[model samples]
Target chain A: MKWSELFTSSVGKKWIMGLTGIFLVLFLIVHVGLNACIFAMDGGVMFNKAAHFMGSNAVPRILEIGLFAGILLHIVQGWSLELSNRAARKKGYAIPMGNKGSKWYSRSMGLLGTLLFLFLVMHIAHFWVPSRITGLDPVLIDGKEFHNLYGEMLQLFQGNLLVVILYVLGCFALAWHLLHGFQSAFRTLGLTNNRYLILVEGAGALFSILVPLVFALMPISMYMGWIK
Target chain B: MQHYNMNLTLKVWRQKNAADKGHFETYPVKNISSEMSFLEMIDVLNEQLIKEGKEPIAFDHDCREGICGMCSMYINGRPHGPWQHNTTCQLHMRAYQDGDTIVVEPWRANAFPVVKDLMVDRSAFDRIIQAGGYISVNTGNAVDANATPIEKDKADDAFAAAACIGCGACVAACKNSSAMLFVGAKVSHLALLPQGSPERKSRAVNMVAQMDKEGFGACTNTGACEAVCPKGISIENIARLNREYMMAGLTEDK
Candidate 1:
């Protein structure tokens, strides 16, 4: 096992997918938790404060670099694996068995992953670029300046039905992606024993449903004027 | 069991060699008994073809029973016909209707080039086995079966994994044509036994390397392989393979 073979081999690529996938899953928890502060009914005060801390903290800023790299590596390795898998089978069967062999989502991970990739780009453009790269308008709280990210969210979601819809759709893609990926990553990492597999799969299913649902709800709640 | 007759129209793939482009040739066989196995029906068709002075279809089969795993055919989009957990040789004509049109073809995968019609070279499997599919110990008088005690559950699991017949059905059934299930079966069978403990780490590393070198696709855990397996080889073997590979990567002395 040379250093080059680790990334070149099929099993190694799976290792990359699983490792990066778990890293992304952990990031989702922190992301959803930070975004969940909007439901506090404090007119974006708590949300903005949390967003400011996240954006300004030195530790998080450094971790953000690793996050971006993990995302790029995951996407590259995933597409390579998909392309090779496709190439392995030159021609398909005449009568295709669609869901008889495996689940629809399990077979369509590449498509789902691509959709999530596009959604991620759009999401970063809307929030990350405006907040971190170009800087956002400052809101003074306790005579301290903080980026009004919650204000930005309201402006983006309110009366902008298309953006809200896109956001919700992004969450939908994320949900399906996580549904297969969460358990799959663990399986790839070699947690295949029956007892632990059952537990991981159960936890994965719950996480897949809850995290995306909350992410989807944030935009819907904002658009419907449910949250200030 | 009730018996009946079927007049099947089989569109069997015909190819002279690996270099030749293959095509389907339709052959009608009337009054096939429901008791006849699928391969036996093919034999009947070939007999008819030979009587007519035409070239007979070439297929690979050793033992008519399922154990040899030498019989490889993709029948009607399935690796081993429509019957669940049955090999092509074990599939009976009773499963088909009176006028069923069966489309038979060879297992399609770049790693397995067709040597002839319905028979692709599966030496890639052999190469993988050669890579590390064995345990090394000095040969001597046969040790008693109970000389080294093993847990009943573990021994049973090892036997289950050992049941893989190197059939390549898993590769045929996979959407990606991946050979993980095959490799996993080999890895798990050896890794579970105390005799295989010495080379367990290197075995995982070497076999997987050989598997990749042979141009097989990565496993996506689609579970299709398990669905069509004649031996009912579990996907849990694949999980164990993954575990072994990871453990070997971490702990093996480089």
Candidate 2:
């Protein structure tokens, strides 16, 4: 097989999707951990500092380009898979098999991923764009100035119930997406042993639930005035 | 053991030939014995059709005991009927109740086109196997089975993968109609064995190339194939195949 087949062949495309999906998940881990700082409730002191460090740093600044590229590749590859898979079966069954053969989310990854993409757009517009490009209002802590992405979270979540609800809904979509995707990325990478798979699945389930739960809690806490 | 008869409403797919646009024809079957296999019920329906001077429904079946993997029917939206770990030939009529309406169709993937009625041309599988499903060995007297000194765990895993009967259920069951499970099973079965070591890399590379050439969709790891597999082949083999493909495809010296 030619080297170009890596992006063309079925297995090759999947390999790329798996590699990139896992890379994105690793980004999620960092994002979730940093976002958890909001729960500190110290007027976004630790949270703002960390967010400022990540945005200003040379390494992460460069890595952000790769992150965007990875996301685009994942979405493009996902679209092709969805289209070809739809074409594979030219006709529908007289009766549908709903969640009989696999989990609804597992088969519906295409839908779930689409929802996540929309959510990501809103999320990026809400935070990533202002923090990185347009520049957010600066707050001073310990005589140092930091772009207040955390303050934006606090104000937005408290002000708009609809946005908060959408954010929560987006988190729900993320949970379902991760539920299948976390371990699925590994499976696509060919980690088949039951011993190791048990660990991967456990971690995946925990990550799927905890990351979204904590992320959702941030908006809910701010909206409900739980956080200062 | 109790036996009973039930009448059923059968909606069967009928296609005259490869070029023909097919449609479903409903036939009401009477006195279907609960004890009879699903294929036997179809046989009864075919007999009735012959008596009525109508064309019989065409289906593929051989070695009715189920090992041949010849039976291919999407009964009531499942690859085989509702029975778990069962072939269409092994699916007994008892799975359905009286007055049930069962819709049967041929395997609906581009690669496995309808030959006629419920039978499909599965020679695409043969082509994939021909690409690299086998390992080369010199023909001679049989060596002792234990001469290879295979690990018990690896041997068990290989044997489990070998249980795949080359049936198209995996392809039929997958929403993507991916042949990954089928190819994975073949790849895993051979890749796990000592004899399979020689062609392991090329086998993964070539079989996947042929599978793609045949126009099958990619696997999404939904495990639909694993769920509907009559032999209960696991998707773990698919993971193994992915690993094999990645390693073989990337590191090839040529």
lDDT of 1 by residue, B3-88 (tens): 99989899999999999988889999999999999999999999999999999999989898989999999998888888888889
- Report interface Cα RMSD per prediction: 1.3, 1.2
State the lDDT of candidate 2 residue by residue for B141-222, as single tens digits: 7678789899999999999999999889999888888999999999999999988988999999999999998988999999
Against the hidden true structure, what lDDT does model 2 obtain? 0.91
Candidate 2, position B244, lDDT: 93
Model 2, stretches more than 4 Å misplaced?
B138-146
Computed on alpha carbons, the lDDT of every model, listed in order, comes to 0.90, 0.91
- Minimal lDDT window, size 10, model 1 chain A: A91-100
Tens digits of per-residue lDDT for model 2 on A1-228? 578986688888888888999999999989889989998869899999999889889998899999999999999999888998889878667766667789999988999999999999999999988987898998999998889888899888887899999999999999999999999999998975787999999999999999999989989999999997
* Native contacts kept (model 1): 0.60
Clashing pairs in 2: none
Cα lDDT, model 1, residue B45: 95
